[model samples]
Target chain A: MDINWQFIISTLPLYQKAAWITIKLGFWGTLLSLVIGLVCSIILYFRIKVLKELVEIYVELSRNTPLLIQLFFLYFGLTKLGITMSETTCAIIGLAFLGGSYMSEAFRSGIEAVSKTQIESGLSIGLSQMQLIRYVILPQAFAVTMPSLAANCIFLFKETSIVGAIAIAELMHVTQDVIGMYYQTFESLFMLVAAYLIIILPLSFLLTWLERKVRYAEFGN
Target chain B: MQNLGINVLFEGTTLQRLFEGLMMTAGIAFISIIIGSFLGIGMGLLRTSKSRIVQFICRLYLEVFRIIPILVWLFIVYFGVTNALDIHLDGEVVAVIVFSLWGAAEMGDIVRGALESLPKHQVESGKAIGLSFWGLYRYVLIPQAVRRMLPGAINLSTRMVKTTSLVVMIGVIDVVKVGQQIIERSIIKVPTASFWVYGLIFILYFIICYPLSKLSKKLEAKWEN
Candidate 1:
């Protein structure tokens, strides 16, 4: 496999810019999804009437569809309805729309895992509903949900690759651009794989460490 | 925008093309699932084997697939390998190969989870009955593990189906690509064609995946009870 190291070196700046965009998308996408997920889970836990069912339908619709189609629909389809967004905006929205449901599912499972007896005890101690959820339920659910939440975070980051489809200059986009320009397919792919590994491996370790910290604090094991 | 009726969806054999695209997507997903299941079951069995080397290899395979996005893998097989090695491979074939490998890795993990979740007594009873290792897996372990594996397997199948859309990136004319084509052809005449086209594709995917996901959930709930 003949790899052009010089070509790859020349393209480092392009990749750095693309990687920054990817990182930005991942950051914003994960944050939005987390907020959306937490809110939806809270709504479900409280059993809110119309909103609860709306959240359920939203979750199913988003989760059942692929992110690529979602991006297309958002970036291409929605423009027909006179709602326009920049590619990055559309990508972020697409990521959150998909990731929110998965994150909500993770959080819902975590909430369900909080034993009924704990909620009852918190209520008996005169904690209001909001306080009960805030102090008693969410902390435990957050701890139990940490692992899946971390997984979802990584999933969202990896998913940023799809944003390249909508013309966003992310890592995959840059890699493809390099290949197209230089015909350095091997070098371009090598850089692509390396960039993802460099970002993902460290993130994976950091998240694993964070998960362990959460578990230890919660369960003392 | 006023002419954005359902007519655009049916214009010039658009639905037929979309149907063909959907079939392509489904075909890739179906073939991969079948092959991946077989390979996965073997890898999963090996993963749970007593040998440390076997376990480590399985873990490595799973992690590699897990970390990188499927799009990268798709590009590697479809473009990188073909271009770098100066070989020819159909876009669809590369998609199948990559998805099969991915599906195997994912399914292997699922199978491993299902097998490991089986209680110790299941293995012991087979041994107590003087069964050989293969006989034990055949009669006792597999029968029980299959039950536990079904829901997860179904879930994985749905995921494979969804991920198949990524094949469009490799220039495979799947449903998403078909929608794009329809939109590109009529963008000027039907200003809102993309809305209808991509919307239909979205619903098409939803139609295929929703029931499977529901079925997975149903089986999981039923089995849990």
Candidate 2:
């Protein structure tokens, strides 16, 4: 194979920095998605008639639309409204929003998995609504959400590559820039693939760790 | 651009644009299912093979295909992976290849699930009737398994159509890309109504996918009966 060992060696540090950006966006995106999703899913779990329908519509619309369109729309549309920032932040925010929408459904399903009997049990305790959810409910729901959230994290990590279109200095963006500068298009992209592997392979192991730790009746061993 | 009532839906050449994209989308969706189904059946059975090595390969195929997001997969196949493999191919060809692999994995799992859902008694009776393996599958097993698999397979097909939009990221110019291009054009010509273009896209996707989603749900209910 015709390889460029020298170029990769020289750019390894730059790639490392880019990797940091990728990791940060993915981690933050997953966090935001989980938090926001969990909050919105309360309406769905409570089955609050009109609110449930509205959240369902929100979830479906978000799921059906592609992340890229949403990114571009928010990017350009917000800029026109005088909201501007570094492209990296904008891209990460977009990733978070998109991932958050999907995460809502995940949380909703997880909450529903908690069994209505648990709700009756909580009511039997005569605890306040807020106290019941805090003490009796959310812990079990979060446990069930682990395996799914793992799969989603890996996907979100790869999705950071889309930010390259908007010229963020992440791995994929640097990849394209490197190719353009050196004209070693294939080599640059191959390096990016290897870069992705280095980034994701560790996270995959971590996911397995979390999933195993959660080890409940519902999820896999 | 033409205007009709308060509903800007069917007006201007928007209907024509949507029609063209809808046909392409449906054409790809239907064709991919036909292709993915056969491949999925083979892979699904291959996964159930007694040989450990064959099972390992099936698992590896599913893992790699599943872990990577479809958009990234499309980019790599159409651009990076193809370049590395040194195979020159068009965007659509690459899209179909990647999508088929994805569809195959999902379909294979669905096939496996449906096959497993069947009771052992039915198979035992087929064997008691002195039917051969192929005879049992062709006459008894496949029909019932196919019924159970229909809803999921159709749902996956609808998903395949929705996912065809990812082809646009690699520059295939499907409905989404065409919408983006039109929006850009409209931005220059008529800056007053950008929402119209996005709303058009949302409607177009609905027109294409909503019916499929409903049909799949209906098929599921019917199959259950």
Candidate 3:
């Protein structure tokens, strides 16, 4: 019946430490996924013969299955193949693979959004394939995909909580541990919610701003 | 192959247990999606309401649910709130409630987008015909909105199905949880149990979700046409 503000306040330091870990996981996860997604999208855009189908299958499998199961497969199934990694490494890799699938879809759409005429024009100017991609395709695609990329980043941030299931000592994991020690379930969860909102809300605002800026740059204010 | 031992999947009770878990997963996702659609429609209409206070409340609901991860929300309901209130609800009940809450927020956004995208003159024409607010929505708005909203709502349904896998964290005995248990129990007897068990779980989810996602894409393309 009684709420404990004092207890919640006192636990802020512990939660803050966990929050830092979450942010780190999210940062590295998003970065890794973004690179993977970019490569996959570029490969698909160029229509690489054999690897294209393989990449499509990878994306479909990751997209279709649950992240938890994917995490489990990497964490548990990999052990059968004699591949061992720490919980944190597995969590980061799992998140990257999961986020990469979605990111590749977003980037594919972005690349497709670039007009065919642009590439043709670049070719007519004697541009190499690489030059055409660098000069004519990627910039515009980056602008088009920025919003979705930002949204994916936020999704990855929230997904860091799932790492807790694998005992990665992320935000949710630490909060659960704190609850086990003190039994302040309500207070701890309330603080956890606040911690996530604090990170996400500002990130969302920044994304919106960046989206607008990109739009303006593309079209003029 | 010899080192892996005989497959235990088709052995006595293992298949039945996995089937039950699969059914539980389907049942929870189905119930939550249906219930969440209704709640979402209500919230979505509220979001587009003319009243400022109603709109603010709707925005608050969407923002809070969207910001927090569903796992955290599930934990709050299953562990935190229940503990505080001294209620002993079943894990399935908690999963349904948590998933429904998530589905509603997502579907509400879909509905709001669909409704808002309508031409303003359609509503003006309804008002010009001297129709009441209820008549306007029933006769003028909802019919068109439903068509536009179908693909998005279905997409949300697919997402809910995938997201429900998190219920294993709360001990829901869903397919993932069952797989976890099977692997844990079979480790001594079959060293490769986790590979088969988790692989089967992945396939089960892929079967359920891949078709729905494909259907969603088809519906989206159809609508686009």
Clashes of each: 0, 0, 0
- Please provide, for model 3 over A80-156, each residue's C-alpha lDDT reduced to its tens digit, 9 standing for 90 to 100: 76889999899999999999998999999988888888879899999999998888788888898888998899999
TM-score of 2: 0.85
DockQ of each: 0.86, 0.28, 0.80
RMSD of each: 1.3, 3.8, 1.9
Tens digits of per-residue lDDT for model 2, A69-159: 5666566644644567778778878787778766887776677777777878898979888877786567677688777778777877877
Give the alpha-carbon lDDT of every model.
0.91, 0.73, 0.87
Question: How far off is model 1, as Cα RMSD?
Answer: 1.3
Judged by whole-model lDDT over C-alpha atoms, candidate 1 comes out at 0.91
Deviation of model 2 at B170, angstroms: 2.8
**TM-score rank order:** 1, 3, 2
Candidate number that wins on DockQ, 1 or 3: 1
**Ten-residue stretch with the least lDDT total in model 1 chain B:** B1-10
The candidate that wins on DockQ is 1
- The candidates, ranked best first by lDDT, are 1, 3, 2
The sequence of per-residue lDDT tens digits that candidate 1 reaches over residues A1-221 is: 76667888888888888988998999999999999999999999989999999999999999899999999989988888899989888999999999999999999999998888888999999999999989988888889999999999999999999899989999999887877887788888888989999889999999999888877426631
lDDT of 1 by residue, B1-225 (tens): 356456898778999999999999999999999999999999889999999988998999999999999999999988877876789999899988998999899999989999999999989888998999999999888888999999999999999999998999888988888888888888888888988888899999999999999999999999995
Best by lDDT: 1
Which should have the higher DockQ, number 1 or number 2? 1
> Which of 1 and 3 is the better model by TM-score?
1
